[model samples]
Target chain A: MASFDRHRNRRDNRVDTLSDTAIEGKDPDFDAWLSQQLQFHEPYLDNDGFCEQVMEQLPAPSRRSERRAARFQYGAVVAASAIVAWQFPFDRVWMEALQQSISLYSLVGVGILSSLAAMTGGILAARR
Target chain B: MDLNDGDLIRRVVDGDQRAYAQLVRRYQSQLRFSLRQLCDGDRGLADDMAQEAFIKAYKALPAFRGDARFSTWLYRIAYNLVMSHKRKKAPDVDQEAVDRARSEESVEEAQQLGMARDLDSAMKELSEAQRQAVHLCMQRGFSHEEAASIMKLPLGTVKSHVNRARAKLQTLLQAWREEVVSGQL
Candidate 1:
């Protein structure tokens, strides 16, 4: 329990670094006294097995699962896109893209981006 | 090396259960003590609230941007839980237990008995906002701005709470001061 009794050894100098400029206007006397009193009010309560209780009650590690779920979503979307592309008439689409405003540089850029995406997915899976 | 709170938090967010245990250990006492005061010295309820807050923070850890101090953020969670608990209108704390907790004393501790007892009772008389503000700013040594953030009150309102709380405490404790002057306590 927190009480006003000073914990004998905790704080060496009660006013060492508390310039208290944050609250500086009036009642310097009373403020300083109150500060001293409060500094001594509750020096560090003992753990008393509370930490163990909290740790025991904590739900299992979740960030890894969340990450795994996000990766799975990304993989699923990429797989669906791949399936759709595989079913589409890619040669005609390429011919149309070539005939359209799409430049050689744009095609090369898309190819490089696709390769990089595949590489990223491979690295992520390897790490997993 | 002892990891700082930021490192511990990052580790916890990366699925390090032991890192989170370290955080719970580091903050449990201070958090619980503050909750105890807010719960009117109901240690059991305070402990329960503290536990719940830690669990909530754990579930929300991945989203905890380091915009505020970890302790302040934890306090905000605990304060919110306290507010909801109060809204449910739980039964009042055992008054006898509260009095005994507040007035516990020893031979050497008797020197502060008069002043401490008066301050404790006077603190109970304060509005909840005033009490919280005083605790965060005065007792915990947080700046008024930090207290405002924790309480989700305006900066001016927090300052007013501290000022009003102090004014009341000063008045209520005047007799105790006079007695000290007269060597009565």
Candidate 2:
């Protein structure tokens, strides 16, 4: 403990000297001190097998382009759906079905189910 | 002759996985070290972030214009990953462990161990941007402009962070200078 306190006192004196030097505009000592302290933490990462690990983790190069193509396909499908909805007499068919035994809620439910079915089919087709 | 980074990048873009591997090997240490510092000396987390950055870089390689040096671009990716990770889980720098390490007696031993502790604790005290700026510019020897680009901060902000970080570090590690003055270091 005595040794520890002594060491601490010595360190305190050095800091005072450097602080004075810094005030005098001879900052080289302070800069050197800062550099030494910072350099002490320079990390040397052990990188054996790092390259192999990264290589294994990289997605197949085509995967990115495939994702882009998938987006384009989805967009085309949406555009085609809008054109068909606009051009067809689907509103008349929907109203007629509503006038029949089918309630409006049932018709809406059916539409949702069919959309889900189409999405499932599209996913299955892509997988195949 | 070793291919320059641009050539390697061109080959990788042209579907040469070997060239990509070379790029990975060339920058792995640098990226890993930067991540380690950014992660506050958590080696495992640093390596994980580095790996994620490399994979992300590979996927985004096509979008990489040759505007920035490959290293600066890569560092940017790693820095982003570190920042995202920090958002998910705030990393706790173990100051107690650092304090324990500093309790050792010999001046040489204390200098070695205390400096590490002081630096780590000092770093933890810094704002995130300040820490990144200081590590990139002061420790890693990146030019202020390069560090600014990597951090995506305005040049003035990066400069301010570096200066403030240096001042904070000086105050934190004043004992080291004291040790030097005492002729004990």
Candidate 3:
């Protein structure tokens, strides 16, 4: 069968060298055979549930890690709140002291300068 | 702007999980269908390859620069995975078994005009690429040019492959026809 197969392959390669007349002679049978090739596709397979099954096999996303993340976030919020409470006494009281010592005109000028500075910084950041 | 696939790709790159799932749902069927040809009706392997392809695509999404169609890039990835799979488990693809399966289906679709049972055995004998070329033409109804694009081959190369495959199939069918004519089949 191996020898026969090799011989068959040789004959098939020789087909390219055939004259136009011989090629034309082979055309009708070839066309009929080509039509038969089209027949194999007639009964298309349905893969309806295929996607669902594939999606099912996907490694589930790490829920345990998500829970850990949530817990860490909650802890950070609590820690931040406690720090703020410890520092809260100075936040308002210091502002009152500054307001009392600084003149109204200087305070207004400082406030305007701060606003201009913030606007310039925002524009630079927006350009990027 | 009508959301481009590139936009969806950007969102997926930005860690939008829902956007990634939308991409999956959009392409799953076509990818599965292309892979079904490679797997030889082993739906499980096809599914595995498809999911693996998408996951790999997700991992590599950051590098996608949006020059080509997203589906085209995804197809290239899928074909690579399918090729690697074939290398690993080089399938024997029992022709007789495939023919039996086709014949069983043909019995039900006997009323159709071109539902000839004889082509099943002939088709089963084709090489994987040859079978793929034929399926892309007949089943997917892709023109020779469209198939070339989908298969990522030069148009002339695709034409030659399809022509040679068709010729081989024709020879087998001719023999089958002779057997039938002689009342020997």
The numbered model that scores best in DockQ is 1
- Candidate 1, residues A1-128: lDDT per residue as tens digits? 13222321232243233234423336656666665666566658788888888888888877666587567667766786678668968688689888896987888799779867876776576446
C-alpha TM-score for every candidate = 0.62, 0.56, 0.47
Give the CA lDDT, 0 to 100, for residue B31 in model 3: 75
Q: After superposing candidate 2, which stretches have Cα over 4 Å from the reference?
A: A1-41, A61-128, B40-42, B88-118, B121-125, B172-185
lDDT by residue (tens digit), candidate 3, A63-112: 66346544555565556556755875755655875878966677667756
Model 3, stretches more than 4 Å misplaced? A1-128, B1-4, B91-126, B134-155, B164-185
lDDT of each: 0.74, 0.72, 0.62
Interface RMSD of 1: 8.8
- Colliding residue pairs in candidate 1: none
Q: Classify candidate 3 by CAPRI docking class.
A: incorrect
Error of 1 at B93 (Å): 6.5
Ranking by DockQ: 1, 2, 3
What lDDT would candidate 3 get against the real structure?
Answer: 0.62
Per-residue alpha-carbon lDDT of candidate 1 for residues B1-185, written as tens digits (9 for 90 to 100): 68999999977876667889899988888899899878877777889999999999998988999998898889999999987897786676467766666565333245555456546556676798988898888777788998998888999999987877676555455455556658986
- Across residues B1-185, which tens digit of lDDT does each residue of candidate 3 receive? 24668778765554455566667777787678678657775556777788899888877777887765677678778878887777776766546655665565456446443224436545666677777777666545566776677677888777666676666654445554555458875
CA displacement after TM-score superposition, residue B99 of candidate 1 (Å): 7.6
- By DockQ thresholds, what CAPRI class is model 1? incorrect
